[model samples]
Target: MSNWNGNWESFARDAELAAKERLNEVDRISESNQWKVIKAFQKHRVSDFHFNSSTGYGYNDRGREVLDEVYAEVFGAESAIVRPHFVSGTHTIGIALFGVLRPGDEIVFVTGKPYDTLHKVLGHPGDGTGSLADWGVGFTFVPLLGNGQVDWEGVKAAVTPRTKVFAIQRSRGYDWRPSFTIQDIEEMVGKLRSIKDDAVIFADNCYGEFTEEREPTEIGVDLIAGSLIKNPGGGIAASGGYIAGRRDLVELAAYRLTAPGIGGEVGAMLGTTRSIYQGLYLAPLLVGQAVKGSVFAASAFERLGFETHPTWNDPRTDLIQAIRFRSAEHLITFVQAVQRAAAVDSHVVPEPWDMPGYENPVIMAAGTFIQGGSLELSADAPIREPYIAFMQGGLTYAHVKLAVRQVIEDMHSRNLL
Candidate 1:
């Protein structure tokens, strides 16, 4: 705690103490996750030579091929397409969704609305931008029950003969509901299979990787996609995303990513192979650190009389920590203060307005090495009712601790805490 104690305002001293006590449980989970990563590394026989880069047509790119093999093995999938070309998690999911569904195919989201960026990909309300709907693919979602559980009856009524894809978002995205866990995803898979035997079950796995010991691919999901800059990036990968699952599905996604026949074979890794491999190697540890920070944030904010999701000791499914504020002013201030705590762009203040893909005006404190890296320390929220601030990512537990303390001190100085 020395890093925080030396300069943190005295107002946060009690919060720091309480946060430290709560860290014991976090440490237990992190330690277990650490061993899991080591076992995966050992099982795959990862070596320094595998970090070598490939160029040109990338023919016989053993390093690239082996990296995919390792990712597939670790994710418990038959195949994987991990590349820097897929710009974002949304892009990766788009490839998987578009690859599997035909023009007349219907896509059903059993997990309610997806992340905001996906709304554009799905062609919501038809923006005429070559979205899924524009391509003649149909979409519908079964809203979650009040308890955040899937409305099975509604899902049953929603599925049609043309329903070819059952999409599940493993993370909560901007939603207030709890993110789906591995067990929950497993149950959903069973239920979906019982209804539509051939439906391609896809999981948007962003921010949800390496948190649980087993992945969605390990359970029963047919395909899983995510951004490399999030959980699996290990705070080191500067760009890219990954999709891993059944070989046939991954092959289809690979075709969507590159071309009709090239698939995952021809893309040049450039100079990113080493970093991507290293990032995946370190992902479990980084995710654990982020989860710890989330726990600390939740615990500290709850002590300050704010409502927090998945209260401190609760099992974490993703890295996000949400604190519901009383008013929009409090939410904006909280986001601004979080930006101030950032090591990068601390001087810049964020304002809530219409961000590109969101419905509500969103404020974001994105101070990170990678432009939009959510696996680093950052906070953001939509300016709306409930006024919840969602904070996530910390490359290290200490940084997350410092950031959470800064938020408390900032609120206290304003007489809001």
Candidate 2:
């Protein structure tokens, strides 16, 4: 609760009170909708791929249908498609770009520096296998400013008659910093529309979903893309990607979706109906709880002299939080402790190895029961300096407290404490 930038104790008190106030506001705002949907959500069985649904179904395009309802609730935008086949966030983006642009058209990446994988996708390796550059489509970047936000003037400079799309990525990373605010998106859209009404305005809606009450879909973005496996997957969705956008673009995406696995253009539902649905249902309350856990972890770590990224005093935050240790061994140790913190009756050790397509190695303490990232199960990934000592998943505050304690205990056991 304390704000290290100023008076600490007073800030802590005020921050706590404000947080409680916000919680009250959220409850009041979501009262009817939250109760009806989330309570019922508890009734839905946890979805499983091995036993319950199609073995290789595409992410539920039907999921897109649900996003459609969200769109109507938010923007007046026309259609949506959610597919489980987008193996990673990268694939989902590829599908959206391929679906929207003509072979000879162009797209401008509005993000200053997007996800690491995206640089390649935007034609970085002009001749590499499956590189998007082979398509003859042109791409450009809207350089970001020092604070890690889009440079509006640079964007205008990047625009061209050939530019068929403008896209922004929102997700977890250490490359610049957080840039896309609700206001930034709105302003970007205004600029795009003024430049060219037909130029598609797209956003990579990843870990950022449920971060705020109002989403880009609600703010008039032409298309919003994201991964279910990360957020709405709710530790349930086996795998999937979703695109909610202009009706025609969505329809075209369905066609490209054919090669992936959704049954040739009608779209792959990826048997995610129950899981994605369930994840979405539990997301709001779960996300709120995650922010709380993050606040605790961030504050505690910051107080211990490690650099941290979040504060309980801030408005609301996404589930992810980072604590930089500045050393690979320390990073691994931190991840191990965090995982131990989550296990109630058992412990799991994390392994660090080189990830495919990753120039640098990535480490993860994956203790998931379902063979995927499970918030319900505790885990952490520390990639070295700026290592994020991150953790999420505790059904209640008590559960999170236990996890936090155990993690700290592990650190003490090793004398890292």
Candidate 3:
């Protein structure tokens, strides 16, 4: 088990001991979540017939329709639209926004600037990609306070009659802030309702699903959107996204996804129905493993004198574990080392390049079985100042533990540890 400078054995021993209790807790949560999903599946009578996929116009797709119902029931939403047509998490979120917002309406972001992919989606007027701004919708953001908590006073000042939507991002994108919990969302929903009774509150629920027993929709969020490849897909959903919430709001999103008349009635599943259902069935357990890996990684990094966001003991509502390095080289090496430890593409090296939809040159180490699947073992970071590397996901805790050890050994060999 010795690696790099040969001190990894000692570190691994400590990490295992330190992470024992946390891992047990994760196991407990996984059990509860597994039961919940099982009940949802049973309640919906998901049988082999639901596994069949559709093609062409995809009309009379009972499996597709029932999957939505099961998801709605599980999430406690009035209605849901789950489709392979929606490309990524950002695209699903875009559909939801465009579906609800009208021309001259304003969208207020209470969680600060969103992830890089969103900048293009929220493009300025005439950028010509048919962005919100191009559609004559306005955007405003209220920066979080020094502590990364939402600024209540700023949100109050920002809300207006024209503010049709108040958006909340549960996961802290590339930022060093803590992810918002269910309780936090509940409070935000309550406050927003008081401020503007009619304002729609949409939650970007990417990477946050299954981490908590309850979802944002269960707590009164007007609408919620997530990518299937991230959390809900359970690492098996090849492609797709989900938008669930109030029936009217979901219907609007469905129109955007398909057409004004077709809505969710059309769109073929194309043989992905079974995988989607199975993935959702397994998501809770996989998410728990990922969360445990995150906790273990955070503790391991912190023990070695590196700074980790939402320390190991902190209540986790997402899978991201951000580790700050003193230099860019240290950060880059850490990412490269994770790639070296990959089960799929271990031989391939990753370099920082101009990735689409990102403002900065980014480096990503994703050797997942499913291309671009973040729920599997992966690590990525922007080549930027402060040199923070965000590591997330593992299909199994054993794999994540191995990846973290490899990173430590690589850093130690370079005397960066």
Best by TM-score: 3
lDDT string, candidate 2, 248-320, tens digits: 7777776776744432334445455666666666665655555566565555555546776544444443455
Number of colliding residue pairs in each model: 0, 11, 0
Per-candidate local distance difference test: 0.86, 0.60, 0.91
Best-matching candidate per lDDT: 3
Q: RMSD (Cα, Å) of candidate 2?
A: 5.7
| Residue-wise C-alpha lDDT for candidate 3, range 300-416, written one tens digit per residue | 888878889978888889999999889999988999999999999899999999999987899999999989899998999999997999998999998998999888778877888
Residue pairs in steric clash, candidate 3?
A: none
TM per candidate: 0.94, 0.78, 0.97
TM-score order of candidates, top first: 3, 1, 2
Q: Assess the local accuracy of residue 318 in candidate 2 as a C-alpha lDDT between 0 and 100.
A: 48
Ranking by lDDT: 3, 1, 2
